[model samples]
Target: MGVIDWAIVAIYGVVVIAIGIIASRRQTDTDEYFRGSRQIPWWALGFSIIATSFSAASLLGGPGEGYTNGFLYLQLQLGDLLGYGLVIALLLPFFVRLNLTTAYEYLEKRFDAKTRSLGSLCFLLFVIARLGGLLYAASLVVATVTDLPMGAAILLVGVVSIAYTVVGGITAVVWTDVLQFAMIFVGIGAGIWTAVNGVPGGFGELWQVAAANDKLALFNFSWEPSSVRSLPTALFAYGILAFAVAGTNQQSVQRYVSCADEKSARKAILLGWFSGLVGVGATLLLGVLLFGFYSINGGLPADIAADGILSHFIVNAVPPGASGFLVAAIFAAAMSSIDSALHSLSTCITVDFYDRYVQARTNEKQSLRIAQILIVVWGIVGIGSAFYAASTGKDLLEFLVTYTTMFLGPLLGIFLMGVLFPRVNSSGAFYGTIAAVMLVIVGSNMGWLTFPGIWRSAITAPLGMLLGYGISLFGQIPPQRALQGLTLWHSSKQAQALGRPGLEEEVPDRGDY
Candidate 1:
């Protein structure tokens, strides 16, 4: 790489450090550290949410998917759209009204501590386990563009992410996301522009070639759930996953809690819907452009793995200094994601486990200290796990997504049961979760169930919820009267029972929000 490229990367690093220090100054207590003192802007939180939701997978693997599978991958994105609607219509009001610190806290008040711990356990595994895989994927770009070994690259990334997240907490993660989000767009936009123009044709010519090759094809409305990329199956899978991750996962939940009010929280989510649409579009479209680029030249680049197509193009195609920023964009995507996960992991542990079980009486100062320590510990776990990931040699993205979604269906299902179906007691929720997981494991292996691969989450999540719903219907047992505020229809009554503001404040008359 040229000196200018090196300079650009250095500058990016320096600016990130400056951002951490500035944001760090704003945190005076654990509440501000974890929830941004309810001062974060909705648009900013929306941007951060998008940044945290999709990662290097969307930036790199998306194009790779486009290059290899045509537009079949785009169908999965449709399900994610439904998640935002779920958040605005249902989840936003409840979370705001309760003024919860962690999403899992809702579970405890709704059912029991065991259920709350269960939900938190699922969230921790989903997020923490993905970190090592993310580190490995990001290191590919770092190792390609610099002299660092993959291990060292992973360490460097882990260390840098920890530094900012540990010091600035959620505020740093959000604002840096604004910067990283911008980088993602700029990098993807530049790549698309160059790839399209560099090809023998522009949009018209590229579309002709893409159409002929079916690279632009979308929505094969097949009913077979095992159809890996079918519209019906894939859409179903993504919708369930979006609700599980965006609505229930701590990573996304904490962002919602940081809003100044229920209105801002809802507005932020709406903004995220728009930003998410554009961000995903840019990545997917870049994939289409890359397909056209490679096709015009006859085939994939020589001396490159399929996953390295985007990196290969950046190295050989883009200008000098700009390439550094593009690489920075990849790192930006990676850093944004892992830092958010780390912070969320810490929040989940601190609020759900540490605070509740370990030392409920711990003051804010001690809680803040404990949270920072967990950040370091989880960061180490992620870094250490990268060593094992390198040896396993799995497709990092696929590996991460597979495991993350394994329990997602059951987890989201239980929440749905608690919120929407009041008759569903702890036993019903517990048994249904166990049955859903068992069904997924057996079906995935035996091929008895139509849902397979990533599609497992889609079918499995709703199946679990349905199981919970049906099983609870058979019972004459009702939820404890103390559990009223937690259910959707009776949130106000529950509030009255508990002497808190009833469901009225739980959901404001947010006409448009």
Candidate 2:
């Protein structure tokens, strides 16, 4: 790396620290720390959501997927689109009306404390798993370019992320995410430009080479669910996963709730989903370009792994200044995602467990301090888990998908039961969750399900809902009074009775927003 590249990375780090300091001055209470006082603009939250959902895993692993597997991976976006729509129509309004601090709070209000704890537990597990994979992905670029040990790179990324997230909280996270996304977009553009230019002909040659080798291929209409990129797996399995990630996961839910109002929140949700589509498309195109570049340039070395392809190109092929900028962008992408998850996981722990069960009467000042401490704790845990992730030797992007599918389906199922079937009591939600997870574990291990790991959510989510609903039939239906403002059927009425405006009540759009 040249002097300019190192300077750019250093400048980016300074700016990140400055943002944290600025945001820290504004956070005096838990509400401000966790929800940004419900005053952040929609577009900013939208960008944060996109950054969190896409992360370093997508930024790096996407091109890797493109290089190794062609366009088959793009089909996952189709399922994710449907999932976003479901979140906006069915889940967004309810979450906004209730004005929750965490998504799992709905579980407590709708069922019992135990169910809420279970949901929180599931989210914590998902975050740790996801955080590890993300850290590993980010470290690949750093290690490739700077010759840093993988563990040291992970530590550097983890410590930096924790510093900003702990001080700035959600407010800092959202605004910094806007900057990080810009860097990531530029980095993608540069990668594409260099990859295409590396070939004899630019776009024309890329098209010819990629098409000749089937790198431009988009669809795999195979019937086998075990095929990772098949249309059915992408459409059905990924569809369910998209909903769980966008609608049910705490990371996404926190972004929606932090918006100034339901209108802004809905708009932000749409912006996030659509922006993600564009981002995913760009990364995949960069992959195809890489394929063409490598094909004509004597091909990739046998020693490099798929996940390391983009890093290899950035280090060896790109101009010095731009290469450094791209490396910094990878860090930007990692920080953007890592900060969001850290803040959200900390918020989940504080609100769902600590505040609710341990110290209900603690003042806001004490609570905020506790929350900051948790961010550091989780940051350390994340760094440690990344070593395990690196050892697994799976493709980073698919590993992310597999991690999400493991617990998210049943968690989403519990939410569905809470909102759609008031008859499903707390016991049903609890047992149903357990049964679904066990089924997913056995199916994944025994291979009796005859489907790929991505299909875990699609197959099990429905089973969880059915099983939970059936169990509810044998239990007492929750009192209608208790169900008010918590379930779809009663949300409107309870919202009015509680003097909080229902989502149906539209607010005039202010130009300032």
Candidate 3:
């Protein structure tokens, strides 16, 4: 990389921090810090969600998967659309009407305290592993470009992300994400352009190479149970995975719930899905271009790992200034994910646990301070976990999908059981979640489950849902009073009739800036 590229990277970092500082001026309490006081425009929230989704996993891993296996991976986008639809249609009504701070709070309202606690814990495990993976992937990019040790690069990335998030909160996170998304768009466009121009006969020659190698294949209609790239897995299993992510995960739930209205939230989430599809598609195309570039040339180097190919290409093949912009995009992707996770994780700890249990009487100012402090603490812990993630020697994209399936599957099952099944009791949800997670762990270790990583959630979620519903049959049904406004079967009018609060809370108008 040349001086121009290094300068572009430096300016990007400074600008991100500046956005955080500027956003901090409007902060008056935890609401603004965590939810942007529910005043952020829908477009910003939608764009932030897309930016966070990119992470290092998509930025690097998407291309790697494309490079290695071609367009078969893009099938998962179909599942994503299905999942997003389910969440919007089935789940968002409850969340938006309740004005909940964290997604797990709904578990407590619908089920029992123990069930809520378990949900939060599952989310914690899921997001923490993701935080580590995102950080590790981004750090690998930095290390590759600057010749720094992995640990130092991890620290560098972690500190920059933590600095902005801890100060500006979600305000900083969403706005910076908007800027980062632009950088990512520019970076990926540059990468594709460079890769195409580098080929001997340009896109036509690249197309020939990709077609000859079967890299343009998109769908696999095979019914094999263990097939990871099969159409069924992408359409069905991946849909469940997407629902688990968009519907149940705190990081995702937090985004839409911050919107001023359900309509805005719905539009924002859908926009995120569409934008992410475009962004991810571009990255995958870049991967195909790389494969084409290498095939026509001498071929990819022997030592380059799947995850490292993008980084290696940027450093060696891209023009100097362009390489730096690509690096900046990678940083943008990493920080966007890290910041969102840190805020949501801290929100879980502070709202779900701390405010709910430890000191329920604390003023909003004190709670806000605690949330900020927790961000710093979790950021440090995430950095430490990144070292562990790097040692696991897994592909970045697959590594995240594996962990998401393992933890979120059962968690989403419990949420589904709560909303879709009115008969499920708190006891059933609690025990069912415990049983489902345990079985998944044991089954995978014992080699009893042999399907693709994405299939784990598809299998486990239904298992937990059925187990929960069955157990509920043997237990006392929850009173109709407690079910109001919590389940899909329960409407806001019914809640109001039963002397419960209606779906939407009337928050006083407040300035976001």
Better of 2 and 3 by TM-score: 3
Report residue 427 deviation for candidate 3 (angstroms).
Answer: 0.8
Q: What lDDT tens digits, residue by residue, belong to model 1 across residues 447-482?
A: 776545666666676777777767777764554442
Using TM-score as the measure, the top candidate is 3
For every candidate in turn, the CA RMSD to the true structure comes to 4.6, 5.0, 4.0
Error of 3 at 150 (Å): 0.9
Q: List the residue pairs that clash in candidate 2.
A: none
What is the lDDT, from 0 to 100, of the residue 215 in candidate 3?
A: 95
Query: Sort by TM-score, best first: what order?
Result: 3, 2, 1
Query: Which portions of model 2 miss their true places by more than 4 Å?
Result: 443-450, 494-513
Model 3, 1-513: lDDT tens digits are: 789999999999999989999999999988998899999999999999888777977898878888888988888888899999999999998787788889988887777667888899999999999999999989999899989999999999999888899889888999999999999988998898888899779988987899999999988999755555788878888889999999989988898889998999999999999998888788889898899998988898899988888998998899987898899999988888999999999999999889877997999999999999999999999998899999999888778988999899998999999898989988898888788778877988899856677788898999999888889999898876547777888887987787764556322212111
Give per-model TM-scores: 0.91, 0.94, 0.96
Residues 1-513 of candidate 2: C-alpha lDDT, one tens digit per residue = 889889989998999899999999998899999999999989999988998877888888888888877888888888888898888877887788778889988787677788888888988998899999988989888888889998898888888889989989999999999999998988898888888778778888987888898888788999767775888878777888899999889999999999888899988988887888888888888898898899889999999888788998998899977887788889988888899889999999999999877997999999999999999999999998889899998888777888888878888988999888878988898898888788768876797755677777787778889989888899887765446666778766776787654544422211110
Q: What lDDT is reached at residue 400 by model 3? A: 90
Q: Is candidate 1 or candidate 2 better by lDDT?
A: 2
Q: What lDDT does the true structure give each of the candidates? A: 0.78, 0.85, 0.87
Ranking by lDDT: 3, 2, 1
